[model samples]
Target: MDIDVKTLRTFCEVIRTGSFTGAAHRLGYSQSSVTAQMRALERQAGAPLFHRLPNGVRLTPAGSTVRGYAVQVLGLVGEMEQALRGPEAHPQRLRLGLAPALAYGEQLARISRFGRRLLPGVQLALRVMCTAEIHTALRNGDLDGAFLLTARAPRRSRTPATAGGPDPTSVAGLARARTAVLAERACGTAAQPGRPTEVLVQELEFIPSTSASTRPATPCRQVAVADPDCPSQRWLPEFLRLRAGEPPESLELGSMDGVHATVQGGLGCAMLPSGLARSPYGAGLAPLPGVPRMQWTVSLLAARSREIRDTHREGLATALRLALEHAA
Candidate 1:
């Protein structure tokens, strides 16, 4: 049977709020109207969806099943609405994501340049998050694009290099340069044949139960913190791998500042992006020899809509490219 989007929304709202009155208040609808909508949905499904108790309402088995589907449907519909509204109508809010530590230095300054020159009217929103959150935001249409440290795109196809040469309009120029070792002085430390010198690595603590694919593929000693829900924690392990191997012993810390302090104390080594580590405000830490080097690429993404004006799309692309170049 065909179920109306409105009816499903009303059903989901009632389930979410636990009562028709609560849903009505949240949706700005009259209590009677909300009840009618729920009743209509039940009739369409040919089942009593909710059991009305004296104090509240409980979802029946069928109602619970339908509610699950309704949430997905409503969420997609909301995303579609936002996607169709061009950047202009939406004030061109660019939701840019970056690896936690990499959000500092010239990289941030370059992004600011794009917002000021290319998209003067657009609102640029910067988010420092793990690779997983950035990917999930792009897939869900919450982010315009992101600069990631990986070689590949997590969701969309990679933009090709320019035909004649590297496209000046591409974001590749802004991609971080991978270098072997970053040190103030070159000291010759004779290479030992077999035993790999132990280096300190910092670990990011991510929320538990997150998808495995989103986690970095590296070995690390897990550390427990008061609030394990922080996103920076998830990225800590990967950042550590960029310079050293998994830490043997885990240290539970309260804040990011605390994590940095712990690393500075020489209690253990921590891995941080070059852009972040080399920032003016950075804690002075010497880069040890045999450290691994890596880089992340940032790109702008748009939907394939013929109706979207070419000038606007190209303008956005140019701004993003220039921003990356400035950062480089």
Candidate 2:
């Protein structure tokens, strides 16, 4: 059977949005074009795909099976395009995306300067966005690499690596990206002040259903967080759950800066990166103890494929480690 990628894409989009018109609008194709493409696809497959309906379309049995194949085909095409675009030579620019609130003040300055020193020819284009978005761009070939947060840290009690290189991971997936751990930091409690200097993780239970002595009764127990996609946002609240096992109240914010300001205002305490906790921004907040440590690893992700891999990756990773050390 013969089918074009565009036809398969149209089929998938129609299944996704459940309407030809919706898929056409989303894909910037006319209704006739989408209909013709679907017709072509169905002919190639020798089976009907979508059952036309009064409200929205539904996938036929054969279409359901083909939908899975369509997804895999499209995903592979994306991976191939992304992998082939990566080249070792002096790139137009090293587009590096990072999570927002990763570093501020002095640390941020050092990151930019270090990039210029290490990657001379390529312009350093640093943009701050959520880690998930950074990862997506990295996978899509829009970025050369990214620094994103990962929760794959050593189990609590601060165990050191036994030996060897990072427990070895294979780089396989649509991204075809190689990842290296740049730095590791645990999540620590940060608030305005007036809490115990050394409270166990369990002691956070005392927080909910009670007001801080300094803060308002209503907002005192709230937990501030970055985007929901963040590892810290997902793990911290669960780690610091109430004695009854219910998640505490939360105040969501778009950036870490907003979280800090909210905390300073006595609205809540947030789970901040331990490295940043030691920074000037986290000046006074005390780290809680005895928690099943939620350690976060800053990972350097570079696009990698058999044909072309970034040559400057190791040098850039080294520079990043040095900058992080200086910041710490």
Candidate 3:
């Protein structure tokens, strides 16, 4: 038979408190209300569960049997309620997608703080992917939210818009600006030959590749070939495509550390973020003249339903807004 939890609770409370008046007081109900509830419970059980006695009220044999079950059931119900509402309840899991470029700066710190403050019990899952991949994941529901580049005003229309319309004013816009400023400062410094400094520009050409052989070759330069899969490497072809002349010739190295070592050895320049360049490695590197500024934005994406409860999405957006204000 279908049974209401309230009925069970009222029965258990009356038994524990030993009187209808006491149960009403503990449950914040009037004694009359408590009496009515017990009457209802007795009707449901098809028997009078309590016997009126001189001292107070005593349980009949049937009442005593049901009270045992009621106690256990009510105890379980109370525990379940507390578990759902408790401060120590397990956090909801949230998946967050981010572009490699934005992961390097204050975004990380801001997001961390936002999580600690706003979503204390959230389990954050971070995925670093390219802009295209992030968008795809968001559409597929594999990602609850993402930070990627946006080119135009976000519209509610079915067709997704392209990138690079007017400059954005959203949280993503601020991130782009911050990234651009960092890129500009990091790339502006041109490296001198035989200097013990770290350079923060991407190595566009590595040893006899199309980029290296075609670009205009500079003198007194050492170059290291980095992994093609690196985000820094992905930007090189585009950088060269934008340049007016032939690509420069240079050595190809595998890792970021190798490129740093090469630059430290006074071999050639390496493109890097200003935060990294200005850090310990950039001790002596100076900005090059006329370095083009480059910035990218990361957008948030989610289905309507999943997006509603996405704590990370909200937290990231808040953090992005704060970062933009501070950067501004």
* Most TM-score-accurate candidate: 2
lDDT for each of the candidates? 0.45, 0.53, 0.47
TM-score of 2: 0.50
lDDT digits (tens) for residues 1-328 of candidate 2: 8877888878877866889999999999999999988888888879787678898786653564465456546655754564576665434456666665354223344566676687665555666667567656654567766665543432332434323312211111111122111111111123523111111111111111111234332322467776555554544454445322566677777665556545544566676554445433343344432233334455666655322245566656666666666645
Q: After superposition, how far is residue 14 of candidate 1 from its true place, in Å?
A: 51
Question: What tens-digit string does per-residue lDDT give for candidate 3 at 205-287?
Answer: 11111112223444323334343323333433323423434444556553343444445445565554444344322433443
lDDT of 1 by residue, 1-328 (tens): 7888888877766765779999999889999998888888888889887879897787653564465356446545754686688755665555565544434333444555565576565555555555456555555556555543332311212333223322222322222111111110111133523211112112211111111222234333443221122223322333333334443455555323334334434444444434323422233444422223223333333322332234434554565456444433
Give one clash count per candidate, in the order shown: 12, 0, 36
Between candidates 2 and 3, the lDDT winner: 2
RMSD of each: 19.0, 18.9, 26.9
Give the candidate number with the greatest lDDT: 2
Kindly indicate the candidate among 1 and 3 with the higher lDDT: 3
The better candidate by TM-score, 2 or 3, is 2
C-alpha TM-score for every candidate? 0.37, 0.50, 0.40
Residue 278 deviation, candidate 3, in Å? Answer: 3.4
Candidate 2 ranges beyond 4 A from true positions: 1-91, 151-154, 157-220, 289-293, 305-310
